[model samples]
Target: MAKNLDVIEQTTNELTLAERQQKKPKRKKKKLKAVWMYTLLSIFLVVSIFPFYWMFIGATNDSSKMFTNPPTLLPGDQFMTNLTNLNESIGIFRVLFNSLFVSGLYVVIALAVCASAAYVLAKYNFKGKKFIFTAFLLSMMIPYQATLIPLFQMMSDFNLLNTYFAVIAPQLCFPFAIFLLRQNFLAFPTELMESARLDGASETRIFISIVIPSMRPALAAASIFLFMTQWNNFMWPLVVLNTNDMYTFPVALSSLMGLSYIDYGQVMMGVTLATVPIIAFFLTLQKQFISGMLGSALK
Candidate 1:
């Protein structure tokens, strides 16, 4: 009886120790997973923020110090000087105005044309509608580069080269905007349209008052995209515009690079200035941007 009791006590003790050991491994695994999560988040945060840091640092350093073997990683005191130089070199306000004008015009026209087309495709039934939509989709698949030559030729023939209209007109026909607006319109409540029509509302009146108000999120999203694309456009403008007075921000910035010397500080300042409006625009419409994305996703 004594031997049996001793064996039972030993087995109970061993089982308890085994349970404790298993608990320790599970705790260790949880800690390791937490550490890994933190490490990955830290890396992502650094990667996202580093470019802006370098840009600010470069903006505050002179050209010589900027390209040194060990690049400057901190801010210097040359910011004002760089700003003045950039303004003097390229009439900063004029370039900004040109960019804004072209981009704004493109956004307005694009929204009108695309949204109208999308409304028709979404709400109305006509022969060959699917075929027409398929053509638009195929057009989207074709690279922009492939269409550049033909577009340029058409512009040249129309004598629209070097004009703001040249840039604005082409962008008004964007297929992506058509597709986005169509998708949003498809998801819109048709009962609202029916109610408006029954109340003796004209099609144009209904579209202007009811449809547009309801589709604010989609319109805002499309406007942001159209504005950004027109603002950053470089190649087409470079080929078309020959006068310095008509130069947009991106084109003017390219002039900063010359055969002899390149102004790093001034370039950085210009870039920083260019990026500010876009950031501000996004911040203003961020709520709509998020809602539009979520709405599209849900649909």
Candidate 2:
């Protein structure tokens, strides 16, 4: 019996050692894989951020240095000069005001219009409902350039050219906004709306007091999209707006280019400034935007 016990103990110890040896290679491979992944991600991060860093460097340096051999990797001392030149070139304050005003107002009005339209489409039954919704979706497939000529003609005939109205009017009934909000609205519980109705809540009250509050995340996401669309709108505004005073950031930035020479420093400065508002806007609503998009997808 003693001899058998000793042999079994030796066998058990050998098996455990063998098992640990087998796991060692797997653990090493996992660590190596993780190291490689991190290294690749670090490379990508640097590559992706390099352009913005270069832009900043350009903004702070002279135009001539932008093309120098070996390139200007560090920031220089021309930032103030570039900003002053940029202001003189485009009247940055006025251009900023125009862009901000148009984008802000568009967000507010478009949100209301889209949310109401989406609510109706999502919850209400009426004649030609599916057709109207389908039409909106099909309109998304149409090239925006295709409608430009007719929209321009219509705006011209209405004497809305060179006006903020022209800039804001054409995209007020944004199909994509309606569609996004509609999807989120569909995810809302119909039973809740019914319960509110049973308690003497009017449709308007239910929408204002309950629906809108509950859909804040969706609204934030949609507002970000709308704000970005109007803020970055170049082609439509370029076609309609003739005066420099009415130009938004994109149109204003383009004016920095010239046939004779381009001021890279000023151009970079303008671009850097123009990027601030968008970055700020996104940062403000990023949490809600993520939640809204994820919630809608899950629902």
Candidate 3:
């Protein structure tokens, strides 16, 4: 019996060694694949970040450094100087204020309007419901340029041209926002609304208290889009905003461009400043925005 056990143990050890030898090449292949994947991702990361790095470098350097043969890759000491020049060129503070105020207000108002419209469209059963939603989607297909002239004319007739209202009001009923939020709203449990109704809760109360709290992700996502659209809007504001004091970031930054002698430093500085709020806003709501987008997609 002892001799038999010894033979069995020797056979088991032999089989284990053979198995390890067989897996060795597979393990090496996996490691090589992982290395290549990480290398490619690193290269992509650098490529994606290079433009933003260049923007910063340009912001901190003189205008001439931007066009130098070697091209400056390092940040210089001219950030403050460029910032000062940008302020003088475009009234940076007023531009920042206008952008922040208009974008913020537009996000708030547009969110309320869109969320309500989405909620009704998603949960209610009524005549023309499908037709209305289809119309909204079709409206998105219309060229935005086509509406610009009509919108400008209406604003002009109403004495709203050159006002923040002109900028904020026209796109308040954003179709994409409505569609995104409606998809999310559709995923919400109707049973919960019914339960609230049974408890004598009003529609507005249910929306404000229960529904809104649960829809934070969707709201955050929609708010980001709304804020970005208003913040980066250029053509409409340029058409309407007659005064420099009323110009948003895009319009303000465009003011730095000259036909023959553009100050790259100040332009880069303004662009950098213009990008900051979007970054900050997105970062603030990133988790919610991601979840909302995923939720909408799943729905």
Candidate 4:
């Protein structure tokens, strides 16, 4: 009688377990989707980073070694020669300074202008507000090339050609920067600004203390974009800067390949060096840049 009662209890337990399993469906969809997502991301990561590795290897190897069949995958002893050639080809310090100074200044000024304008457009009610923001969006729609000639002529008229002012000025009023920052500013709590104002905080103080601190991500994202644009800017600088000393890094590097029989190793070294600043800037701000990117759309 005891054994039969024990068997009956075990049978009931088995049935209950089977019923529970039936109630909850298997969750394969999420797991499979995750697998596919990870695979795609890994592939993208490898593809994006592989070129930098290849470039670094090329930077180390000589032209002959880099050009070999089953191209060189390892570092070589020719890096010093490549560096010497690169420095000789383009006075490294001059171009580096031009790029760094112009790009850095452009980013700083653009952030201020864009953030201020965005704040006004987003938070304040005024006449022609819609029109102004519409114009900003419209500017982005227009191809930059269409306005280049007129802008170049204007800069020439202003006697800003071959000057850092030319490179830095035109880009300070960046349409995209304005648009991006405005989106972030839209999400700022109006109450906070109003409360600050009630406390006798001036507009500048309110903005500096309240608005800027809250929108770090947007500012970081804008700074990265502005820096990248100004740093890689080639055509305008080409038109403006006549002297080799005045040329930015990209312009100076391109001049190397314009010569017959390109010493690819030297070119790679210059490319590697030119890429360092951008990488550093991105890495430093990548967290904010990524987080802030969604502020406009999400809000």
Off by over 4 Å in 1: 1-35, 297-299
State the lDDT at 77 in candidate 4.
Answer: 90
Query: Cα RMSD for candidate 4?
Result: 5.0
- TM-score-sorted candidate list, best first: 3, 2, 1, 4
* Candidate with better lDDT, 2 vs 4: 2
Which pairs, if any, clash in model 3? none
List model 2 lDDT by residue over 1-299, tens digit each.
99999999999989988987998899899999999999999999999999899999999999999999999799999999999989998999999999999999999998899899999999899999999999999999999899999999999999999999999998888999999999888888999999999999999999999889999998998999999999899999999999999899899999878798999999999889888999999999999988987876776
Worst 10 residues of 1 by lDDT: 63-72
Candidate number of the best TM-score: 3
How would you encode candidate 4's per-residue C-alpha lDDT over 1-299 as one tens digit per residue?
A: 99999999999999878975875454466677889999999999999999999899989999888778887899999989999889999988888998999889888998899889988999999999999999988988888799899999999999888888887777778888899888778888999999999999999999999999989998998899889999999988888888899999999999987656888898899999999999999999998888776655576
The candidate maximizing lDDT is 3
lDDT of 1 by residue, 19-79 (tens): 8797888989999999999999999999999998888888888878877877778799999
Q: Give, for candidate 3, the lowest lDDT window spanning 10 residues.
A: 290-299
The whole-model lDDT of each prediction reads 0.89, 0.93, 0.94, 0.89
lDDT string, candidate 3, 1-299, tens digits: 99999999999989988987998899899999999999999999999999999999999999999988887889999999999999999999999999999999999999999999999999999999999999999999999799999989999999998999999898999999999999889989999999999999999999999999999998998899999999999999999899989899899899878799999999999999999999999999999989877876775
